[model samples]
Target: MGTLVSLGSFCLVRFAVRLLLLMFRGAEASTFTFVNKCGQTVWPGILSNAGSPALESTGFELPAASSRAFQPPTGWSGRFWARTGCSAAASGGAWSCATGDCGSGQVECNGAGAAPPATLAEFTLAPSSAGQDFYDVSLVDGYNLPMVVEASGTPGAGGSCAATGCVVDLNRMCPAELRVAEGGACRSACEAFGTPEFCCSGAYASPATCRPSTYSQMFKSACPKSYSYAFDDPTSTFTCAGGADYTITFCPGSAPSQKSSRDSSTSSTTTASSTYSGTGGGLTLEDDSWLASLATGDASHATTARGPVPFLYSFIAAMALAYTLLQ
Candidate 1:
């Protein structure tokens, strides 16, 4: 009789522990950290996708050499960009920015998206902790500044989980036809010409119809891991094990030791096809590994194998304890 009671108690305890573990894993929230390394202040803007809840802030000022962090609920999908050359309204005037303006007329974008010719870091976080998160830096809209997105603290298995972005300053070498008149941003061929080929619209909507143009090639050559055009998916889109925190940095290659200083000219462009390199803030571009996987079209083996190993160990230990109590 005593043995039966001990066995029942142990089973109940083990079941309760397993339930708690599952709940704890599902409740994990991902954190996004934004770092600004530019010489000038950058106003970062956020726009959540439809049906997704709003983040803590829609827009805020991030001074040079500063950083801020935000925690969004699970299953968040949104895009982030920086607005430069912003100005506060005078008297009855409206607040505005020279580039990547959301047209909200104030610091907070209030759920508005950034205008074209702005560098954008887009994300679609997984609905659950065990799923995969998709992210990419897109020049399909255009390029306004250099940015890099790095993921950390993600599960070690499934998905490449590599760092990606356009770290080079394309503004200095932007084609004359594509350069913004004020010279702060570079317009996409689509934004400039509005043709079916460049815009990938009309008959060129599908990947089979649309193809990369000279302009898109230039962007691709400079930033191979970033989305050079609307159809750029295979090499541009990156995935990581879910529950990973990301850091998006502006002016990633502008450190003192780098080719360009924030205050000086950023004419020298660093190509992503180069060897895996580390920029400022201890972040490295995992280009080689990602490219190798891209070449073989086997991204499944990119990440180290990791799963609920800790949980399994705990469960085994609990089972042993339960057996001893039953004995």
Candidate 2:
């Protein structure tokens, strides 16, 4: 988990912070700057490794001049969106925004059978800072996920570090690695950003491959000898670049909380609730929920999951073979 400092729309956040500090001494005071990417804030709360807390959304409104987005607590996993100053009702859990991409005016978190929110690249956010009263969020999601671009002309070089499918690190951006290479997404930017006629199939990789609404973004300038690949933000971490002259880093609009053992545990152990809403617009959490309040992590972290996948595969294969020969 990372820290989400100031989100967009900071019209009244500075004032709110002043008021919050006056009340709760040492309260982290993480605020939601994004008012409405698409939906209104229904249930606002500050997410944390310990747990999310419903904020007093009596009067929280964001400024109309920010580009930061919302952020989940250190332990929670979700997406946040916003720009500049945010306006929200801390006590009332309401938000004021003209338009946002929060999904047809509905924003929620933590639930089963619930579709994962749109993927955000460079899930950017400004950590609580002095300059801005609210958080600032920016990310790289060509498709519902963050992205790093790489080019062939400068693989592992400047700008090329993030050409087409670069890996977005928590604190830094790097070349996105490929499980399978040599086509589609090149390991270099020179190859990725060249004319489409140079690519393997005369097509440049784009996120729109997944969503039609984003189809226009599919076409690239054209690559010399490069290809593009999409990486899943939740799991993938390494990236490769085709060229190596520059490293292009996509600055996020906001940042997540610092990663920690406890928070990692929560991500895996905690079950998705039936419903969970956000503030600013006062989203209602789901009732009849079954999500467990637990920590998550690798086996070494006390979280229990299936044992080593390789060992399981071997055993299953052996059993299958034995049964087959016997029959």
Candidate 3:
């Protein structure tokens, strides 16, 4: 009986420790805050990678000057875009959106993807290689609203973080042939023409053959850090340490003032980050604070969330005591 009790206690202890570690393992989740400064209501949609589970809400209404936060599990790779001029039918039917419409019609995307002429914010969080989040604002699908993505808790002279986006409104300046005037969005030349050259497909597939066209150049000139075309990866994507949180703003050039609340100590600080401006189209190495956070691969939140840990520990203790008493 004594030996049985000892063995049981040892197993329980191991199980308890494993449970606790498992709870803390999720601390590295990244929070993305979406802010609507577009002077109108916008329905933001989220799409996770095919194999990854979707985040809490697939879509939600974000009023002007308002914001919402989403916590995605580590290694979540996805894209976010805004839907405009949307309306749902009172009876059970489809939803219709003027621009960036994800076909499902209702507010929630329900796995539906945004249509072309919609600005996009793409991210690969906690990537396998270096554990840094790679993100960018893309006009490759075309442009709807001005947008910016800023990283917090970064280090350096310019804050060691790079903020990237197409903050310029390309709708008004869009070439007449490519303008979707009713929706106030600009369609990409490829979306408008669907040509092999504009789409960067077939013979134009390779980067060597797929050079930026006149239309793509216009987008590149306005938003240098954005993926103006399909082959814009070399200059568009950016990285930050895994612990950093990101803020994506619509109409960023005229973004309104707003406050943010941090839920975890391991999360990035809400310090004011400088706007990133590319001069001479050069790049620099960011600091190591983010690197250190990424190096561990298991770096998690400083403040633990309220979970089943306490109850689990109590149960384990009670079970161990009962076993000892029987012995």
Q: Best candidate, lDDT-wise?
A: 1
lDDT for each residue of candidate 2 in 50-155, tens digit (9 for 90 to 100) = 2333222212232222212232332222223221113444576543322222222223222211111112222221222221111111122222222222111211
Off by over 4 Å in 2: 1-60, 64-73, 83-98, 101-327
Candidate 3 CA-lDDT value: 0.67
lDDT: the better of candidates 1 and 2: 1
- Candidate 2 TM-score to native: 0.21
For candidate 1, the TM-score is 0.73
If both were scored by TM-score, which would come out higher, candidate 1 or candidate 2? Answer: 1
- Ranked candidates (lDDT, high to low): 1, 3, 2
RMSD of each: 8.7, 24.9, 9.5
Kindly list the per-residue Cα lDDT of model 3 for residues 1-327, writing each as its tens digit.
989877886887676667655544544456788876555678998888798789998888887656778877878888999887777665866777778898876788888788988999998877331367778888989987767676653322222336677655567568888988463888998999999999999999989898899999988876677898998887677777665577787655332222222332233322222221211111111333322222222123111122222345655666576556545
Candidate 1 yields a Cα-based lDDT of 0.74
Cα-based lDDT at residue 87, candidate 2: 42
Please report the candidate that would top TM-score against the real structure: 1
